[model samples]
Target chain A: MTIPLRTPDGRWRLWPGLALIAALAAGAAAASGALGRYELNVLTTMLCYLVLAQAWNILAGYGGLISLGVSAFAGGGAYCVALLASHTGAGLPLTLGAAPLLGALAALALSVPLLRLRGDYFTIGTLAAALALQAWVYNWDFAGGSVGLSVPIARSPDLAQTYLLACGAATLAVGAAYWTAYSTFGMRLRAVRDNEEAAAGLGVPTVRYRLAAFVLCGALSGLAGGLIAYQQIAFEPGGMLGPGWSINALLMCVVGGVGTVAGPVVGTLVVYYLLTTLLAGYDAVSLVVEGLLLVLIVRFAPQGIWPLATRYAGTLLVRMRRTA
Target chain B: MSAAVVLNGILLGGLYGMSAMGLSLVFGVLRLVNMAHGAMLVLGAYLAVLITAGTPLPLPVAGACAVLLAGGLGYVLQRHLLTAMLVRGANGPLVATFGLSLIASGLVALRFGSDPVSIPTALGTAGWSLWGLDVRAAYAVSFALAGVVAVALHLTLSRTRLGAAVRAAAADPRTADLIGIDVRTLYALVFAVASALAALAGLLVGVAFSVSPQSGTSYLLIAMAVVVLGGIGNVLGTFAGAILLGVVQTLAAAQFGGGYRDLVVYILFFVVLAVLPRGLFGRRLT
Candidate 1:
């Protein structure tokens, strides 16, 4: 129906927000072109991760599936594009389109079987799936095995356009995540997440909602994967399916507050800034720091920084009202 | 392919069973999946290596000493670090254990410099052949040690007061506390036993193969799979799951080479999760 965005309180105060987002995207794109190539590449990686992590939030944070294998799905999409690009005469656009579709297909296949698990079993099952997928890619000689396949360098001689394109993809993903999280279906998903048995009793079709979240999560992660493939211009199985991406997604969701529209964005920016500045060139140290961060947040700030901020904001509003 | 291979798988499964028992025990008692369990195993292995480096004591004695050390460390960790964080929620334990895992891995990396180390054992070049199948001395020793550990564990769990207290805590901490069981003491003892078991598994692995900082992850994953497959909160179930996993792994390795071995085991794990969400050995085993 091509409906415009509608927030939680269904007010017609959306045009300004859209305009602001559009301006911000434009500014980010322009800044990328003005910055150094390395910085631009880092920004691209961050944007791609933002999309992937936010998409995973749809399932893990909202629907409460907590899949730790998002990188596996992302890697699957990357390998698909790499293999297809090598064989066929497809362009970047075609690769981007097919990557998400293929990822969605994989999700559909895995979800039918995986959705049956309960509690931590589901999480572990998904992790096992990720590990197995990595193993498959590692040994599957046709996909270049563990060494991975390389993407040809961009011959277009235009860095600005590529930066803009990546930004656009990221913005599109954010919009998709926001829309899905705010829609009526999203409400049903929340109901399911809150109490699956109760939701099922209320005829919310809990399994269907979960499967939809899984599919959406898979597609968005695939888009991010395709973007990453283009940005790196290479695909490596070990690098793509590594636990770092999984940990990053978890960190983002936990820090930003899962089940919120702006949580992942905030989480990503915080984590990315910390990684780029504070913990640069120290992989083991960073991992320990990250692990500590996760433990602290889960223990002391389970509601996350955003949700806490929101609560304080609400309190401030109430104080102003009382004073008036 | 043959009885010997099945027997070997069964034997190896015994050790895997032992590896997973500690993790399962902790999870059952606390409902906290310790992400650092593998790190504990590595810590135990390294401790064994350091203690018996030039000592005339036999490898088993050194292994026992390592277990005691690991148990003591585990007691301290549970008393100090874990108790504070465990009250929040299930995810609290997961995250805390993750942090502990990082610390353990980093500390080991710092101390050991990522070098692979093996405990010196005197069972070199010895084997018993049955129907023309060669069984190595190391495998025999590993299997025997594993069996001893498993039997001892079974006896401890089934016949001892401490084991009864541990089981009570595992079943219901609140109820156990109401019945005058000191939960703090039970938790410490459970952790100590679990860590000791991890250390024992580490010693077996070290002498049978080799040990390094990076080796813990693979063992951790396998232990988790075993716990999940056998159903959580049950020691015998862990044993059964471990043996099943061992057979699956060895067969997969023999059939598809090392690359697909893990892949096949993981596929089975997923299948088990999908079909029997409660695990192959459900709560009934506990």
Candidate 2:
């Protein structure tokens, strides 16, 4: 499942991926003028998802946690930052700093006990944490309870700036994912993912690596959540901490390719686009489509779209070499 | 605060324990983390709601139909979808079941809408007083039913041929196959039984409280927490864990205001995980 990004043959598939992202960003920018407010909102949301999906990949695909509580981090970031911003005069910088910091602290605190939970237990524990957190947030008066907290800052109603900022965040998120995936740490992460016991037996410090991945994922998701609060100008506990967010992240990674740098990007785009475009008018259609995609991918394409494509490409290359 | 409140908690714990038992059963046999177990419970409630809508059928019959519908779904999915994923080892079924859960949720939402619907029952309004505490008959009935389900499940596992097959499958899948037991069929049965249990729990809840599309996650979380805190695949452990949770939540609500119940539950879960990783009853299934 190791995708060959660099080789003696030097196919350099990374360039094509970067080019595609750049082109999409540029195209999105151009469309900002022509697109309606509704369309812009969808695109911006897609970027928020991009950030979330990538962070989730870092935790589940790379690290062996398979956490179902990434939304906890995101929602924590959203509420923490939104509340601070509205209540204080710290502005966006202080709010943004608190988002990742609070999220990281939460990760550290949760992971201490949570890291002890492995596999399905870990997933369930994280989910319980998320649900509990959501309930807590909903009941907290400071968080605006069920009514949600609205940001006091003014912004363009057209959402062009928000979409553009989201694009940049998506790019950076993908970049961070690529950097980490190609690093030595990433190799260890894959090793851990493949077999934690085996990796630990080989002195892989599985717990530490897993914790690091969780924190990284949590921070990124928190940042995304903060950004979303900025864009939407509201931080609803239901919106941030719901199972739907977790599902979307898992769907994106699984559909595009789990354990790959580019997988979440592609998966998020496809899933988000399908929901916003193809199933635009239908109610509850997104859930069905995403659910079906997850089941199908887990059943049929556990290696995901990227690995499948590379396998086909390898076979094609072999055939070409034979002909030559 | 009084005998009835404590009694009510105990009764609710019965259903909670019953709700989580099927989940424990599935995990024990298939080694899958079915995130949709709560969704299954909700589906059961939905089925009960649908069946009881303007029907002359007795409450028990409607409850049975709900359980049956859920059991049927479990059989279909286990026989068709989940079995394929089981061949690949642990994580396959875990992810697949999660996906199935999402799909089920979507279907339920699409069919039922997001609105909360309560099952109308005269028993819910009826109650008895004992030791200066008020008690609802509906809660008591649901609780008693849950206890029966738990006892029945335990007997089935310990006494029945199918129970033996399931245990054999759980103990060693390949060996079970070698012994001429249909591992596939056993899993399907396990799923059916689990689904039935979930539906029963759901039906009980519908009669007692309210059912909605969004309520599944809370039930699922509590069930999973109970499963983990009880022990990964231990049934008796689930009963203990659910009761422990029921008490913890009820007490937390009583003390810290209802808002902090979750905080307390999570803290309790964390403490259990930190202190006893294998849960309070970590005994390996015999």
Candidate 3:
């Protein structure tokens, strides 16, 4: 008997997935002109959140690195765009292009000290880094101190352009996630996550894989932040580098389903519509609801809504066939 | 910096040590980082504030009540909500505690209006001069209280049979359970004790400084710094580390500006982590 080296689900579906994604992106772009300003803004925000959620999913779900510092990269990217636009007279495309590079560099610098810690220590380290970055920004006169700086509106992208940028970033994020879902790189990353000692015994370079994932996550988050900056012309450090960004990304991933390609997309849509849009202006109420949802989900539905729903549907299908 | 500033820093360090003690204890025993720790601290402060404002009880009595209440809440939470999640995985409890923190912060904000508030005390403006050094009366009392608590905790963990059981359970829960230790109940008790310690620290923090709904994360960061510097789970080490951090922060504040003190401390924390991941004192129970 021949033994299969990989699971049936491990087959790469990248080409078809890319085609579907491209079609969706094209459709969204076409519909953007018809969308009202409010709807366009909301959709743009959702897309940016989608990018962040996907990045966080890859790191925490697949890499087993639960980071609470998404804001560091996101805010760093936003600041990069803001600084370039305001001081260097960089146009939108250049600023956006430079944002991810800055984010990748920052991640590289941080991974030296941060990646040394393991598990919860790493999580706490990331939180510290995020908070430290926020504090530093508050004191940095070059970054406009606590008051924060505004990107020059003339050089910034309009709402439709921002939406298109967000869409492109979201598509890239999803594609990356899909690749990670099926690629050999992701399989090795998961092996390292599941058992570092075992993976190392198999000759996997654990640190290198983790560093790559971290930098990729940072780069994607930075791209999302650039889109956010374009969306909000007058951005402050508090709004940009806030814990809210981390919380939102975490909530989306946990609520949708971590470690799955479709999880972030579903999560972003559900969270944005259910908590953010429905409970707008009631910050305290929304926070309470979000917290409650997170607690209940982890306690009862730890696999998250997407995975749970899929499993339920699978069982239902089997039950129907058996009955028939 | 002046000698007075150093003295104040030492006093501040005492409070910092107290704030971190519960977190260290819980982490040491349960191996679960209570992300809601800062919120619990703020909750204690708010409880004390409410007790003083609504009732004629003395501040000391009110503070004790707040501590007990917080302990009870912690026990219930760990027993009912956190116990099952513990087996799920490392990320499970961490995420759950984070959710709890959000809930706590949101509730506090809803009730307290997000405005800064402080515990009203005669000691707020009172000062004491001892051995040619000036100290605030509140700081002096808080520092003494922290010392007493630390010594008591150290003695309890090392000298008592219950302490022995707790230590065994912490070292190996499966083995301890096989030996007839009710690890679940012990976990809850340890969590309760940690929460009480956090509440005590919170009360002290309220007396020494202003607190708002949003103060939890900042205090949590300070406690994390202390925990890391003192060596995670080391009670006395945490106390000493807090003092060191306090001194350095005060000196930095004096050199740069008050606004950059947090930045300086955070950088120091990162440096310490990079240099000594095991912490300055290394991890030990006492």
Candidate 4:
């Protein structure tokens, strides 16, 4: 019966925030029609990144699980859809529908072993699992081994349909984030994050809450993977399950203000825009710079890259107002 | 498996034990996983490779210098960078170390051109036949090196006053400080020791196997699995775990082929984590 607590200072602005997000998504969807195929594909990938980042934020920022295995879940989901589509002659609808659940199941099984660990142990364990999964996929015969599988739909999805799908998923992901950020469930999760022993003392089922967050986040990551496979139409398991995917998603989350509802969406836009626009031709060096940026950001602005940006923006706004 | 496989596995185990010691030591003393450990190991190998390529110095001397260089770098990193991060809390250190790993890997890639490089030491091309089993000279040398390092570290921890101070600081830093121990210096020393050990392993790996800039993740993963299997912070247990893992790895590779070896090890690790969360010989609850 408890409504979400949106602000630490106890304000109720969840609905308005969600409405703003909905409006932004609608505007973006409308804008997509005017974009060329190349630009549309770029936006679609960015949307996928936003969803993935949101999923990561939910687990690490809110649930206190610093998991390094996002790629595993995403790969699991991608493989499920790809396999179903290729082998059983399943349509895109059925394969995509089952994708997230399959990912959820894999994550649930993984969590049994993983959730038993905490702190750095958990991080290490997850990292091990991730690398192992990648290796497994590389060796698995049915998953196409190193060559990977191409998703063959009975009817190929057009660019517009794919764009819409990504937009819808991103919107849903952001909405889910907003709900979690303000919902009583999110509050309980935060309580567990801040002080698990105290939360347990107050009768919170910390384990269950954590498991729920893990599975939910896994499902989100998995769906993003599925969407990537679907959009690209052909993908290697390495691309989906590589350390790069996890690192990119992690960068986005940290850059955007982890645990904030709009952080992932905003962060995704800023990072991808810079990567695609400013550093488009400098891929190799940009990667090195991104890695360094991660270190500098963690050291200098542990709160996030966006939070620092917001501070400067606020100062500028104050100065402009004063001048006016 | 054949006797050759068993011998090679045992030899491999020695290397694992040697590397895992540094990782295990840091966990025992500082309670940080040292994510940059793998990068440090690769950097050590790269340093050895680069120095030997440019200089006429013997492999042994260059290796020693590499280890010392790694130790000094570790000391500086801990004192200068990680100290401030530690004050923010555990996550700060974790993220910061991860960042260091990222930077190390990127720098390695930029320098090494993403290509695999091996040490050109003569041992890599030499071997001996013991009874009916073939023994690679590099593996045998690495085994001997691991034995020497492990015994030295073990004796130091058990018999030395400095070791006593480290154990005391590890057990209770605040109390150790109350009792007049220099806790900060101890942390720096432990970090340096851990990094140096990683460098030693890196040198061994460079001689025996090939390494690339991208090898950091795999090395880190192996180090983690060893530490966990051996028991979180127990050095002796880490040795046992490394031996067990080395044997299992050889057996798995023999049974399932080469490509499947990592898969087998990882799945086994997950199974172990599930069934025995504390690890086989773990001293710490984590």
Which DockQ value does candidate 1 get? 0.51
> lDDT per residue, candidate 2, B42-161, as tens digits?
898888877877587887798888888889999999999888888876677777878777777788889888898777888767887756677777767876776777777777887888
Of the pair 1 and 4, which is ahead by lDDT?
4
Lowest-lDDT window of 10 residues in candidate 2 chain A? A152-161
lDDT: worst 10-residue window of model 1 chain B: B87-96
The candidate scoring highest on DockQ is 3
Residue pairs in steric clash, candidate 3? Answer: none
lDDT of each: 0.77, 0.79, 0.89, 0.82
Where does candidate 3 stray beyond 4 Å? A1-10
Deviation (Å) of B147 in candidate 4: 1.9
For candidate 3, write residues B152-171 as lDDT tens digits: 88889999988888899889
Off by over 4 Å in 1: A1-23, A30-32, A154-159, A309-324, B1-3, B50-62, B76-87, B114-116, B124-132
Q: How does model 4 fare in lDDT?
A: 0.82
For every prediction, compared with the true complex, DockQ reads: 0.51, 0.67, 0.78, 0.64
Question: Which residue pairs does candidate 2 place in steric collision?
Answer: none
**TM-score (C-alpha, index-matched) for candidate 2:** 0.90
Cα deviation of A143 in candidate 1 (Å)?
0.5
> For candidate 2, lDDT tens digit of each residue in A40-76?
8877888899998988888887775677887888888
